[model samples]
Target: MEKDNFDEIIRRSIAIRKKYHELEMTHHGSEWTVEEDALAYLTDAGLVGRDIMSQQLRWPKVGSEAELEHKLGENIWWLIVLAERSGIDIKDAVHNFLDKTETVLK
Candidate 1:
């Protein structure tokens, strides 16, 4: 994908997350706490691992390929949301991580 398209997808993901946050606040009298968000993210992340395992036949198949794909996307969405909520720029964090890892590996 083009850089612009990738950037647009990130932007859209962030916006969708913000919308869900608002909905939660409206319905529950407040949005989820950071810890709750972290736990939710972790739950989905664990599911992704399990999905992969199932696909590999290391575990019984409980989920479909489409579910695995959704879980992966959801994990990325959670990462972006967490970074935004923590006042960090996801793009900068990713770039810094890659640069530092590349330097260390070299």
Candidate 2:
């Protein structure tokens, strides 16, 4: 995809999250914590192990392909939001880092 396409997708995702927040506000208007949100996503991703790992994550069933895929897909929205909130354009960041790596590894 082109730069414009990525930008549009990011923008659309932001809007979707904004709408989610709006609906959430209608129920729990006082809640607003980015740290908490990130933690929630981390748990959803099943990366919260050991100190926070649940049994399902530590021991998946033999045919649990869909569960793994769902967990992986679920946390990306939080990452996208984190990048946006930090004023770090992911496209530029990825391109710059890749370019640096390419040059140094050459």
Candidate 3:
């Protein structure tokens, strides 16, 4: 994707996180804890895994590509939020991974 698209995705993810935090504060009296966010992130990851399996099995009602993409995006959002909470720069982490992979591949 283009830099613009990636930046937009990050912007949208942050916005969604902010909205969820607001809703949680309104209904639950506080925002979600890091642990809660991690658990939710794992749950979404599991759903994505299930979707992949269903697609591999050619299930009649498997999640569509768009649905999978959305789930993956949500997972990314959760990961970014979790990293931020943990005082990690997710962009740096991603770059590190990419750099390592590139070195190994080359």
RMSD of model 1 against the true structure: 2.1
Clashing pairs for predicted structure model 3, backbone only: none
Q: For this target, which candidate reaches the highest lDDT against the unseen true structure?
A: 1
lDDT by residue (47-81, candidate 1, tens digit) is 99899988888888765578899999899989988
Worst 10 residues of 2 by lDDT: 47-56
Instruction: Pull out the clashing pairs in model 2.
Output: none
Which model is ahead, 1 or 2, in terms of lDDT?
1
Q: What lDDT, from 0 to 1, does candidate 1 have?
A: 0.88
Local distance difference test, each candidate: 0.88, 0.68, 0.83
lDDT of 2 by residue, 1-106 (tens): 5455767767877887788778778989854477767777777766524213333566544545555555654566667776776788877887899999999999
Which 10 successive residues of model 1 have the least lDDT summed? 1-10
TM-score of predicted model 2? Answer: 0.65
2 or 3: which has the higher lDDT? Answer: 3
Q: Of the pair 1 and 3, which is ahead by lDDT?
A: 1
Judged by TM-score relative to the true structure, which candidate is superior, 1 or 2? Answer: 1
Number of the top candidate by TM-score? 1
Against the hidden true structure, what lDDT does model 2 obtain?
Answer: 0.68
